[model samples]
Target: MTATRVILIRHGRTTWNASARFQGQTDVPLDDVGVGQAQRTADALYQELVGTDVRILSSDLSRAAQTARALATKLHVEVGLDERLREISAGEWEGLTRDEIVKGWGDDYDAWRRGDVELRLGGNGETRNEAAERCASAIVEAEKAMDSGTLVCVGHGGALRGAIFSLLGTPAWPWHAMEGLRNAHWAELQYTGQGWRLSRYNVN
Candidate 1:
């Protein structure tokens, strides 16, 4: 048996998110609204996935793990942790806002925002391609552990988006066509035997 589907879910929002600050690999927990979102999302997912073979995986970060725990509790399954699912490391820019980053690294930030895949974020962070590759690898690893079941991967926005870009084999850098996932939103990908097909994206 092989995994036929993948559900990529972004963790709930944090105070940092509300402030437009970069959380990159930070262990920030979910805010109250985020907790509510997680519960609602878990309820919806439970309804959709009940009686189906499901496996829940999550980033080791607190925010993502917390969100994953909600779903896991609903499904009565243990959440598996994968460090590779962590958000793109922003290094010096971890807690800074976009404006702050732009103020400090104006040229580089501009290039990064323009979808320059080669730019190392925060002067010492992971490149877009690098993050994408690692995320893709983590997804594959999760798939290998499952057999013909829907694999739910809970993670940060940037890393999960990078996973989608890599898994879909998109040639375009930065994948401007794909928007970021809202807090607690999810994207679904199906394996058509021939290749992976996006069944749904940014679904709440």
Candidate 2:
């Protein structure tokens, strides 16, 4: 049997992203530049997926949803919003920049980057593991729902990376060692009955 394929794309950069802010779970809309990036991404996918039947899925957050919408328009397909695909909740760190985080939380920011889950980013923030699990479950569920053909999931940077790593069987502890996936980048995975195998990763 042919394996099911999933194409995962990260949403275009946002104003907060340009400003180097922690935008987790924040409903920030795309700026003009981001919209342009989305259009470029859609165009790239258009050429790649020509004559292919595919479904688009996106995080319910506006940034991801907007990106998916652009791609869906290009592909002439409807976009499905899934809350499980949303960015990791950064809670109190939501709108703060890196410098601000260092000034406010000091070593906490460093610890978080170093993959320390115990060092939460203020109240209500999600651990890296929590984000990974949520992303993994969503991808698994989506694969099960699709009968055949390609599927696109547009989400945030961290969440997208987490999902891809999980699907590739990469351990959570060394996730930081993995290279960061760029804005509007695409990763592909093939799902057989036994499990998922990485076909491509961090492709722009």
Candidate 3:
């Protein structure tokens, strides 16, 4: 079977992420520790992907773009930004800390934790299904363009999980069961002519 490999990398932690805030759609910069994490990830990818032809892709957001840039530089390749790879829109919860969200939007926050896609945070936000569809479409497009080499996509944690689960044909709702992905963590996938298959998930 013809197989194409894809590497899904989560962006480094942002300032809001360090503060345990809901960072969806918020343009936050990476903290010092996050920068270090990105550097280390770049180094690892450099060693692992040397002399291999790989297409580099990342979310349009700055945080993910920055992390992708690091890897692209190490691999000497240009990075491509895909809007479909953006994070889930968190609406009014964007910059709010966990405790602050609990205090301000208690019931909604609880429902979110319970994986209720219908539960809107504040007034408007991208539901889990919406995020999954976008991410999955991006993956399909990437797979079609990739022939024999690797395709590296750097995106947000939530969106990355959504993409992985969607590719696995799992429900988007119960995202919590998918486990949290650390900054700079990676998920490896192999795509056959039929579809993509997961080889690993959340590897740092």
Candidate 4:
């Protein structure tokens, strides 16, 4: 049976996040603020899921792994790492600022930013559809692996958003319709047996 609930958490903020740089698959560690945020999130999550069977899975990236570890430690559960949950690769654009990307790629970058699902990021990165498929597959696989209870997946914002849309069978283009997830915040989905339904969004 699938997991009864799923929580998709965006990793805590990083220095790059603060500076508005594209992190891509970079292994950036969490900044001090991020660490604090993770701890607070962990405490809140522990209180909420104390008696529930909760499993945590995270992207292999340092930022995501660190966030997951905080919660898993609080819950006294080991975290599982999944590469498939990593951020959408920024390729050559990793570490670049929005302005830099705009100056370099011009209209192409604008189109991608506006959510042209077919366009690969960073001139050579995975398309939104590709990222969505992989991220959604990871979540679905984790859900099927669990007999019940909640599954917490810690990952990057873009990838997490794509997973949500993908799971709901919604179009990824014009992704701006939804705002990006705040750091250390999460979205919740309930399995309705037939499909997944969003229960909460952008919750800390």
Candidate 5:
């Protein structure tokens, strides 16, 4: 079987990110600093990913899509936007800060961090398991669609990390064992006979 190589990138910073807002699937745009980050990381990734059959896929949200566009342009390819790659919906938590969450939903937040995958943080929000499933499904289907190539998937922090956890065959209890990605940083993985293996994490 052809190896399914993947470069999983976290989208660049948005105004919400800088402001420490929840963001979620609120469709925030990248900020000025984020634009520079995208360009710089695109240059770096273009060099790193050269000579591969590259296909770019991004979350339909503006922040992620913008990041994908920058990197895809550098690689001379059009970005494929997919709504499934979007951030987990925060529902009522959207636009709130971490401190705000702590103040308002302290017990709920703590319980969630303590491995309550079924606990929904906000009204009409997704559980951790649900978010992981959506993220993982997108990657799995996309991998099946491509015979061979590097799949550069750009998405938000929460959703991207959820996908990683799901792909690793780990339970949500150990979620914090894997740290979240910095803006524009990427993790590289390859599907092989042995299954998916993480080659590196947080490479810029």
Candidate 6:
């Protein structure tokens, strides 16, 4: 059987990102730097994957959708938007900066940084397991749309990280080791009948 390749790209930087604020599900758009990043990324990916049968998928959020649109334009394809690809909701912590969060929920914030998946960021945010399950399911479902080819998923950092863990067939524990995806960078994985293999991770 042919393998299915998934290229997971994190969305470009938003104003919130530059400000070091947690965007969560805020639907923030890409900033100027982010726009440029998306354009450059699209150009690179176009040269790399345009020769193949490529499909583009993105989170419905503006930031991710915008980045996906750039790639779609390069490949001359439509962007498939999926909410399940959205970032993990941070609840009350959505708009806060790291410093602010530290001040408000010091212990919980430290716990989260220490890899406690259940220590919700705002005491009401989506748990790590929940985000991982949803994002992984979305990726698997997206793969079903094509039999054998490349699927580029433009998503948020948190959700994409979750997807990476789930798709790699490992428990979400020790997630701290799986560094977050940098803006406009990507991780590539191949899915076979036996399992999924991470070939390239956090590549620009």
lDDT accuracy of residue 133 in candidate 5: 82
- lDDT values of the candidates? 0.89, 0.83, 0.83, 0.91, 0.84, 0.88
lDDT tens readout by residue for model 3, 100-186: 888988888888888886665655888877887798788778767765678899898887887787887776547678787899889
Model 1: per-residue Cα lDDT over 1-204, one tens digit each: 679989999999899999999999878999999999999899999999988999998999999999999999989999999999999998899999999998999998888778887788898899888887888898988887777879999998888888888888884755577888999999999877777788899898
Candidate that would win on lDDT: 4
Question: lDDT per residue, candidate 6, 51-101, as tens digits?
Answer: 788888899999999999998987889999999999998888999999999
- Candidate 6 residue pairs in backbone clash: none
- Runs with alpha carbons beyond 4 Å of true place in candidate 3: 1-3
Off by over 4 Å in 4: none
User: Would you list the rank order by TM-score, best first?
Assistant: 4, 1, 6, 5, 3, 2
Model 4 lDDT tens row, 8-73: 999998999999999999899999999999999898889999889999999999999999999998
Candidate 1 — which pairs collide?
none
After superposing candidate 5 on the true structure, give the runs of residues whose Cα lies further than 4 Å from its correct spot. Answer: none
Candidate 6 similarity to native, TM-score? 0.96
TM-score (C-alpha) between model 5 and the true structure? 0.94
Model 1 TM-score, all chains together: 0.97
Residue pairs with backbone atoms closer than 3 Å in model 5 (clashes): none
| Residue 49 alpha-carbon offset, candidate 1, angstroms | 0.8
Q: At residue 117, give the lDDT of candidate 1.
A: 78
Q: Give the runs in model 6 whose Cα sits over 4 Å from its true position.
A: 1-3
Tell me how candidate 1 scores on lDDT: 0.89
- What's the TM-score of each model vs. the native? 0.97, 0.93, 0.94, 0.97, 0.94, 0.96
Cα lDDT for residue 1, candidate 3 = 22
